[model samples]
Target: MKLFGSYTSPFVRHCRIALLEGQAQGTLECEFIETDIVSSGKLSPTKKVPFLTDTLYDEKNKAEEVELTDSASILMYIREQSGLTFFSSANDYNLFCNVNTVLDAAVNLFFLELKDNILPTEGSYLERHSERVLSALQYFNQQEYPTQAPFSDGELRLACFLDWGLFRKRINIDGLDNLQALLKAARSYDIFAQTAPPEGA
Candidate 1:
């Protein structure tokens, strides 16, 4: 199996973290391929990072290769291959969706800010993107988690999004207690540390 993406992308970081955990569990064996997604079309139809190609053995013992393009699909395939469904319930799935929404907003704002050469101002699509990011963070702040909740895919994606947002200067997460706590907790894991985005990437 091989995963293609850049180091700075939060979506890619999420998959890298999964690969670490899955490897520790003895269920994953993948090679990481860092490349320019915008210029790389041979692997991804979207021309984006977080693409995965897996060679699975079929019931007839034949090698069959499959490709997964989006981060969500790639993560789902990882869970399936590792036999580790990190989402425990519908609530987990909802949280995963919420985090992905924030990720989308952050990416959009990042691009628009670069294109316009200014921070997202009021009454603009970029401003709306900023609003969505903050609202999602605030909502996540109020989320209740069981004490000592084991790290799961939802948490993994959330941590990656928050950290990447801060790293890229996409949004502010001030005073979001729950999110801060979760981020701190996630960083304690060796897998999270191992998958940290490259400096200046």
Candidate 2:
């Protein structure tokens, strides 16, 4: 399997953690392809990073084909293909969805700030985005996950998103206590430590 995306993207980092965990569990073998999303013309369809390709086999003909595009779709495809449905359980699935929503909001805020070189003129709407991000962080800070396992898909994704957000200095979120604990737990893992996003990414 091939996973394509940039190192700095929180979305891509989420997928990368999943891939690494899957590999450690012997569920899948993943090849990481770091692509330049801004310059890459191949990801035009989805216009995003973390595309995937897997070979599907036919029962009778014994043929193979490639599948591609979109991080969520690709992740689902990989989970199904590898029979690693732990992440797709109905209970965990809901958590994944909720956490991903928070991640999306945070990423949106980051990009909006980036749009004007991190300087917002008075009366700019960027404050609204910042408000949303802080609200989400506050929400997360008050809740506890069902498990503290390092490899739980929801936990992994959440951890990756939080750290990547911090690395970019997009939002301080310093008061989010639960989030800070989760990040500390994530950092304790050697895999995550080694896979930290590149400097200035």
Question: What are the models' TM-scores?
Answer: 0.90, 0.82
lDDT of 1 by residue, 1-201 (tens): 999888888999998887777787785789988878454566677777878888889799999888888888888888777778867888778888999987988887786667776667844777787888888888888975433435777877888998898888776767887788888887777788778887887
Q: For model 1, which pairs clash?
A: none
What's each prediction's clash count? Answer: 0, 0
Candidate 1 lands at a TM-score of 0.90
lDDT of each: 0.80, 0.70
lDDT of 1 at 79: 77
What lDDT is obtained when candidate 2 is compared to the true structure? 0.70
Off by over 4 Å in 1: 115-118, 145-149
- Give model 2 RMSD, 1 decimal: 2.8
Please write out the lDDT profile of model 2 over residues 60-158, one tens digit for every residue: 867686766766677666666656764647756766777687677667666656775564334356566566666777866777753245556767777
